[model samples]
Target: MQADIYKENGFFLDEWQLLEDEQALPTEPGRFLVSLERFVAAPEAFASLPEIAILVRAGDDVTVLAPHLDRFTMVAIEFAAFSDGRGYSSARLLRQRLCYHGELRAVGDVLLDQIPLMRRCGFDAFKVVHEPTRRALETGHLAEVPLYLQPAARPDEQPAGARAWARSPAGLAR
Candidate 1:
């Protein structure tokens, strides 16, 4: 099937790029998105393929098979339903257990309120559901303010010990 490609800000993207299940292995070098299930089923096939990586649903449980965290360019968490928080945990695992340092993305059934939690977990990009208007993608995928300070393995942030913060002086006066 011909995938729907959205273009905005001079960039073109296959809507499936947001979903780990919908994307396919790369035919050429560079960045390639893969289905987490297929990767877990047969990761050896991808061994020869390099320079690019995959983004998959957190439920794929592919972490045990991941050879190198840097090999992946991105990891996308799939939210099959708004109530399904498995994706959120997947994001956290990618940062915690797998030590992934690529663009973590949130895909499928994304809700506005979930953005904050998604970022906290790990997702950096979002593929909002299709809707009317050209800017639907923008309105659907919102960025959270103030980068997370927790001990997370983010792409460009320092890995730290347990997150700790002293009580704010303003609150101590109370």
Candidate 2:
């Protein structure tokens, strides 16, 4: 069974059902998250499906998918590997540039250490397969520092310090 982790009231909780690889697309009406490739290849097929979501890989071009953002209830960005940081950029683009308001999820290679950064980048849900990471999330001991030096896509984030540039018209520090 695949377990999905999501944050609720400042704590992580498991509450999601990931569609299996071999399962056929549900035409009978239901919620399902399809791979980015599948969705891109045949968008018309899934366009009318109820509660559709898409899983974005590291190399996928988010810009191309911008037009379809409103069609999905959620967007899952795959980390693939901890060293690969493209997912972070993708999340930022989706939230900041595209203005996606639905749930943004982080999946694969989701370590506890990366959760804080992922959240800052606009990931509200995380699919943590690692046991240690799961434990850390459950215990609420992810060792995350609330302070961030840079401004992120989320409006809720506060600058690390008060600076003239930080409060400038652009709202970004030099």
Candidate 1 Cα errors over 4 Å, as ranges? 1-27, 130-174
lDDT of each: 0.61, 0.79
Best by TM-score: 2
Clashing pairs in 1: none
lDDT of 2 by residue, 21-88 (tens): 56777766666878888877778977667688888888998888887888988898998899999999
Residue-level lDDT for 59 in candidate 1 = 59
TM-score of each: 0.60, 0.81
Q: When superposed on Cα atoms, how far off is each prediction in RMSD?
A: 6.5, 3.9
Writing each residue's lDDT as its tens digit, candidate 1 over 1-174 gives 432332233224653332245456556555556766666667677786764445555356646645756667666677888888888777777777877778777777776667676777767776655443224444545445454555554566553433333355765566
The lowest-lDDT stretch of 10 consecutive residues in candidate 1 is: 2-11
